[model samples]
Target chain A: MARHVDVGDLVDRARQRQPRAVARLISLVEDASPQLRDVAAALAPHTGRAQVVGLTGSPGVGKSTTTSALVSAYRARGLRVGVLAVDPSSPFSGGALLGDRIRMQDHATDPDVFIRSMATRGHLGGMAWATPQALRVLDAAGFDVVLIETVGVGQSEVDVVALADTTLVLLAPGMGDGIQAAKAGILEIADVFVVNKADRDGAETTVRELKYMISLGRREVRGASWRQPICKTVAARAEGVEEVVAAVAEHRRWTESHGEFAERRRHRARTEVEAIALESLRARLSARHGEALDGLAGKVMAGDLDPYAAADSLIADIKAEG
Target chain B: MARHVDVGDLVDRARQRQPRAVARLISLVEDASPQLRDVAAALAPHTGRAQVVGLTGSPGVGKSTTTSALVSAYRARGLRVGVLAVDPSSPFSGGALLGDRIRMQDHATDPDVFIRSMATRGHLGGMAWATPQALRVLDAAGFDVVLIETVGVGQSEVDVVALADTTLVLLAPGMGDGIQAAKAGILEIADVFVVNKADRDGAETTVRELKYMISLGRREVRGASWRQPICKTVAARAEGVEEVVAAVAEHRRWTESHGEFAERRRHRARTEVEAIALESLRARLSARHGEALDGLAGKVMAGDLDPYAAADSLIADIKAEG
Candidate 1:
């Protein structure tokens, strides 16, 4: 059933807080449908209003619990919230954890809350490409706050940092030490640190270690700013989560006062544009030059051309075709 | 210092088992030096002989230890080995674990063993872009086996699987279960599952659980005859390391006989070529059209143009300029 989607109508319903409309808009973004240009044109003005917070941590950390607690806290304050869980797994398998849904069941009936899971689906640079648009959809749908949660593994943490206004890096007592966190390259990107599962043993040790590590590292001064805070939370029991929320608010305020918020958003928009442009060019190249690419590869494999020269020739061919 | 490098001489020295020559060639690859095309051209005919094996597991799961043990085992067979440890952490920070080096001290002085650590360095798609060339350099330099070790965190595993002919997924007792492995999405990519720390409590349970899970999943038949094997190992003590090697050989034999080996290599080559081409296009776009990109992004941000439309316009501009 191919039909027209009225961008104006969708925007109106989204502004009116219609969950179905919001879901449809997000689906449009996820699918990268032909109407994506219209959807982006429609949603652009309504964005830059929602507070984007990113939550990430290694597997086995209480990211889901913390996210759930924060959602309830925001809902209690009468704010609309949206949660985007980026799953870096096979998209066809729907790898969204059942445990995550059960933990988030508290807000399942709350119309003010929208939770969506995005899978990588094996696309090249897929998560980084799709997330900004998804965030925009939620932001335009009138959510007061949007929380992006991702597994803090390798590049995903970097990707989340680029999209979030304030990023929270969660840790647990026995999940290695501050050095390991530093080794994971998350320490520098973290705006706030949460030692979740504080009710467990060695929470204090984790907190102390993180503080020591943070102290040793040189903090980049974007502007007149605040210090990154480390909070302890038993997210499962909803303890100390309010403190995390407060830290996020505090960071947001600091960024706004220092004029860094606008700067960050501008950088994000530029990055999103570049990613899309690159993807578009790649698609065009592949569609137009599939045979040429294979021929070049065959030559490279047969030692008739080096890969670098082959790449140069391919670029030249693309330009000539253009 | 900017003197010309003789690519043929470097390749000759590398084939003659000179570690300095191998290191220099790898540096050229990592830096994306202008001479990389010449280097690749010189090295192409000598490539594709090494058996590439990928070893990955979660942090603290004895991946480094297992890798060290396997290296020693391979060396005992009078085979030259190359180790490329992909650190997903900061490239500039050189966050490669001192423990990794200290553990592999046994082979540090062995001319036949070349160990190198590669960091992501904050580049876009850096690891995936750099690993293939690095592997090719090693393969062409006459290593009998090249072991690619990466932290089994999220997307890094997927990257490693693409470059390896066989992949070994390591697990330990008390580090969660087969379900956790499935959640991590490593179950499907693994050719061999190693229960490291087999002396620890619950080791038998981990092995059995992994076996049961592997049985339940539908394995893709890429070759004539092969079944994923589960092995138990105390890597620290070098126990069962030989069995892992034997399994790698068995998988290699199966793939070669079934023609999957050539097929996989062709796919790997195709992927590498595509990555290089894409990177080349991105560089060209940035160099030749920086202002155009910024202008498009500005338009998108100001709501005058949607990002998709802006991208289309940007592509059009590039084509026109070409």
Candidate 2:
């Protein structure tokens, strides 16, 4: 783990589409290596070229199948693709991550497709915190497109919308997903919606419900020109997948023309920068005021002070020291 | 929101078991109010008398039903109970919160029982970040027990363990939850297991399978005094819920005797205080260096600086400004 890392050399190889180099760079991100700045520095010049698409939905909605099919769809156009999966149930967390590289196995041997899992495993931060940096890694690696997939659980799916240029919210019929899509607050986040497993019963009803929901929610995004599209697909059979591809491309065009593209990139950059700085500040506080924090936590534990007041005292002590 | 808040008076009323006062205090926590520190200061003296319990698992494992039953069991013994739910599918997260107060309706009129949902709906942080404050509110308000229920998704369930004294992981048969429990990194987090809906087919299989998984995972916790128990429950009928209550009490006794109880409280305090300080520092950095962050973010957006280097530059600027 302490070996000297030649970040520049790795970036060069990754840009050349050398698969191992791409995987190694992502490992550095996943591992939170000391050379992360060097790697990010080296990769920055080559980024902002790839399209980042986020795919998210409830479990059992065929998210993995849709991701695999989308990979194939992109590859059909001779485009190189990269996938970064961080979902708990996705091919990512532990033994399941390795064993169930699952449907993504279809493109395992393709030199043009790179699939890597960013396991938090209690690393520096969470899926939301690590994603932008990973996206930048793939973006700079010369992948024509990168698809980021996360399970639609709680705040995670909402975070995906921040890291992606175009976000797809997937649903299947009979999952009561239309109401779920509304409830999860994902209706406003999606750039496109994919109704996978469309061959299943009640597909039409799900699609219609989503369409009506879209119309209802459209007023909120009045100035935003990209109308979220509903693409129906039997992803298991690869039916209607190309239309999703077409829909994503159309979304990219709208974002690019409307200034939303660069704005989204800036927002992503702001989040990544702020998170890194916040983590650095947190480390500094703990290291310099370890005893102060212990005393404060003890005070809170003993009911001598509330957590917020202790927090204020700790910050004041830090400032007073200066 | 702009009205002057009488924090001390409110805390007095809440501790006196005035329902609206209790509800008002939690809303302050939920809203991340400016008066939070004052509220916390007032509540601190009344804290630490309540036991905190965490109820979590995959959706549809009858968590609400089990929770309602547990409230009844505890109320029968003349103990007041408070429930804080943050799960998206649970009686929280929007209309579902007010709409599907669901099985909890049984306890709606029971003044001795209180249920509140902490909605993150784009508030300060995710459920993980906001839960401790909410728990503190419940604890100081004189509830005998606080049950924090979050959807078992990714990192949120793990967060619950850090907040709970006795964490119950629930599962329904035929849901493949046995495997999910292991894969989701929750097997090690459970203090007790509940197989709810025990009348259904495969209930025995689920319980047996969980026991096997727990045994396999137990070696890691080497010297822990508490042996994780599997309690079979048909919560809808309140069957076997007493065993769960008994198990929770027994586990509490072990922790209180073994110093684990105090240690857990210390850890929770440390997390809460640090989060508050970190958030304060984040606000400071953004307030003082908004333009600098914008400049660094633009550099990253333009591929001139990687996010980490930009982060470093921003930090250096902050120190220089000081």
Candidate 3:
């Protein structure tokens, strides 16, 4: 629309502590517009200043509560923090439901803590295409730490963990049948594991189950305790809350010492750039050959030819058109 | 890599009854290679011939059982059916962990049925990228109906259903939390609502809750029956399986009569192509610039500038190099 926003200018404006510029930069990356992707690419160097922690769990497992507690812990340590709470968007409205964001009001009045609610707008990618870009904005915004909370415990939610330096998976007692969180990929990548709502029944059983599951799947990496620590917490009561925070800090130390933190972030950066580049390119191709593609689609629908063959012809046609 | 495998040749071989050809065709689409996107564009027109039915629910809702029963019912009707059992990939091994393919035991030896289990392999779009091409392959391979079973409930799973002609959402009894599925976007896309494991306790209550939620959320659409039918079934016993099949057919009939089926399928086809194009472009860009991008990422980690600004420089450098 306006030759797309320059990622560099967006980054510069965001550097100047401009909210609208930060929002615009996130939009550019999320939309994966060609111009915006370019800008995001330019801003990629300023990331890694902040420690990224991913918080994920089954819905209603007190992930928000845990995130709120984590924010408080960081604030108590006199550290600035940013929380990117990802919420599911209504398919009909394409807006965030914001149900979980209501639980994160403890830090609303604290200027040191910045929280943003994002909706996964069915943007081909489960997370809005711009999420990594948004994270970069948070990274550059001078926050000492940024915590990403996924909407749910699905594959896309798992991807959110991959984008973080330390992933903390929150689990609750008596949630579902005996299916452990690791079985769903939640327990696999977690640098630290947290069992929230420990005041409930089956807390011991849940802890035992998580321990067993982690033992079954734990990978031994050099110089780092890959053993996913089990921290019990009653989030609402703030009981054992500081222990979870300590576990996160311990994890950061282990990752940094083992040099895995920089390695993982580098890989994530590559993945983010690659994914955005592809999304942008595809949008471009779709706009150019949409009509010819429609014509071919009509012919295939008429039962004149099969889809594979039809695809072949269309590719040739697109090449010729180009 | 051999010019990325010719889409037409692969299609022709597949049409000529070559099994490996079909497998390779699927691999192409799954990889979302630049060449395969073209193949998918050509394949979309021939897709509407098959009845694309989507099955989704929360993890461990007996969704796999329900899908198995429905596939068995459709096969008994003398229809050639293709089952795409989508499961989450193991985070460690990057493959199907529980072996979803083995779960469809009844269809194993039936020539008229083709069963395939797919996992989301850390792709930004996950199964969304591979689904349409996979469906097109099955459609062109002469399957009368294609069933898509998603791994988890949320927006991505809902997107899978939106691409289908009929969507059946399964809920098991005793899950007081099934209402969360409705709130999370599963209820809106359901052509047929299924309360699976009807033999269990609280089945009736689950159905009542679903009905209540549906009633509250239902909106009137012109010539569209937004009344999602709640069908109960004991999947383990294969009881009430026929009614589920009947409901799917009934929904198909109504949509066809109102011309919504054809239109939705058309929209789905185009969207599928767009997804492929984007994924392909991503794959290509990632391949070409992955290492150079990684080099820039090292500096980003060292905090030379903001990550956003770093990304901008990398994108510009890549464009200039090209």
Candidate 4:
């Protein structure tokens, strides 16, 4: 099955902006193929040149429309653009968000733009593990700006913020959002705010709520030197999109000046390394622990042993076997 | 502040059917308090007596209405029941699902019924790790049956299926669900199907869809001896609830006679024990891996070291240190 992919040749083709090569590289990352190690080695040097921006918000906040607008904005500047529509499908629902692809058809015929819809397949934490790799593939392929849009303002949204240098938290007018969905964590991660569908009612109030939340967040000592700007857009018409582009560029300049840009990237790399290492360790313990855990599970099920004690025995076996 | 509280005393109170004690024990499990090992050891012996049922579906499928109906049915049978309404709130939305609580107000004052709504606290995998502990607390406290209902038909629903002795997958009329949300995995886990909101426009169509999906599922190697019966219900009025309750009872009898009861419990215990052990191993690696991984991450960011190489070095450090 294409297991014998030449990593170097693929990276070379991707660097020349071959869309299929880029797709193949990203597929390796998504599938967790064995060649990922080699792909990473080949792609690493060419990454870190692209600017990563994450767009996240509640469903119906016009994320796809906004993403299309942003792609048009960046492409006008003569820069290649890459889009990852990361759908956090209900693990059972197999809900692939196929309709989103229809919305992005505007860019389908453009050679300079790569539009992809990726599902969080198999595991709850699957996207977190695979997304950075996909970003690396895009980055190495020389996409000047990569826009990552995730559906829903859930854990996946927060994860998108971690992967991006600048995060745009979008909201639609008339939603009467209480910032309750921002959960205390997203308030810390959002770099810029975008009020999409601003032509509708309550747009000003949504901006007011975001402003109030930002002021409240400032008191808690976040990027104190950089003030985040709020931009309004009717992305369906590409109205006020340039203002968002300006805001992102401004945020980038501020972060670079404050050294927060490098710090964020380094921090992201640390998380990436730790996750990969932890997964490796987990795999090492799995085979040996399987049979013993089955027996211990039976004991616990019968009320003959507690779970905590059984867990200890399982971990203790790992040490003894090693 | 309650650090010095005696685990044995709490267990004693919980066993006497004290709602406060049951609530307190669940809080410990939710908060992951230091006394958990003691609480788990104490509760393990008294567990294994409760029938755990999981009710999950897409939002607005009348899960709470059905839950309330089931609670009434079980109470009429003179059984004390515990309801763990596990709300998998969007990690950012802080969405607590408070409205569902109001629906269950009918049984709020009854000493025989205890209802609690728990948020997926911090981690993405938080629900999977904590739900079982909460179930054990309720099981140990002598509840005849425990209903575990989650917000969405996502990963949390699948987790509920793993925890449930009988899983009721509910669907509403006119939703046109293609078993797409069931995602192949839930179809294998659902023991009983309920077409809720039967008084609505498309109830019969929903039931027919379920039957078709079940028949399609039967062609595979799943529960060959048991043909899952779909009961149409307007749970808001408790119509047709008795049939659904009878279906669950029949399921319990089948699982018990077929030995799937012990097997499922054993499988769940194995998963629980593995999660706890992995968490333990993860903690042991954290302190040491933190400093080294930070430096490696810097290199990875600088492109001098690829992430895979950095991860390998980090894991090697673990083996060397241990």
lDDT of 1 at A108: 94
How does each model score on TM-score? 0.94, 0.90, 0.82, 0.81
Greater lDDT among 1 and 4 belongs to 1
- The DockQ-based order of candidates, best leading, equals 1, 2, 4, 3
How many clashes (backbone N, Cα, C below 3 Å) per candidate? 0, 0, 29, 4
The positional error of residue A312 in candidate 3, measured at the CA in angstroms, is: 8.4
lDDT of 1 by residue, A1-322 (tens): 7778998899899899899998898888888788888898888877778899999877677788899999999998999999998877742135666778888899999999999988766556677777888888898888999999987766744765667899899988766666667667777778899999898888899899888877766444234246779999999999999999899999989888888887777777777877787777666556787788778777766666667777777767767762
Which candidate would rank higher by DockQ, 3 or 4?
A: 4
Complex DockQ, candidate 3: 0.27
Where is model 1 chain A poorest over a 10-residue stretch in terms of lDDT?
A: A217-226
lDDT tens string, model 3, B107-189?
77777777776766755566776776688888887788989987555555566667888888887775434545644556666
The local distance difference test score of each candidate is: 0.80, 0.77, 0.69, 0.77
Candidate achieving the largest TM-score:
1
Question: Which pairs of residues collide in model 1?
Answer: none
Candidate whose lDDT is highest: 1
Residues B112-170, candidate 1: write the lDDT tens digits.
99999887766456777788788888988899999998877667447656679998999
| lDDT by residue (tens digit), candidate 4, B259-295 | 8888788878987887677666555556656788788
Off by over 4 Å in 4: A1-3, A57-69, A88-98, A117-121, A153-157, A168-259, A320-322, B57-73, B87-108, B119-121, B153-161, B168-260
Clashing pairs in 4: A93-B181, A181-B92, A181-B93, A183-B92
Evaluated at residue A237, the lDDT of candidate 4 is 97
> What TM-score did chain B of candidate 2 earn?
0.91
Off by over 4 Å in 2: A88-99, A173-177, A180-185, A200-226, A286-291, A317-322, B87-96, B121-126, B173-177, B199-212, B221-226, B286-288, B317-322
Q: A19-103, model 4: which lDDT tens digit per residue? A: 9999999988887789989999998888899999998765456788899999999999999999987765443334444555777
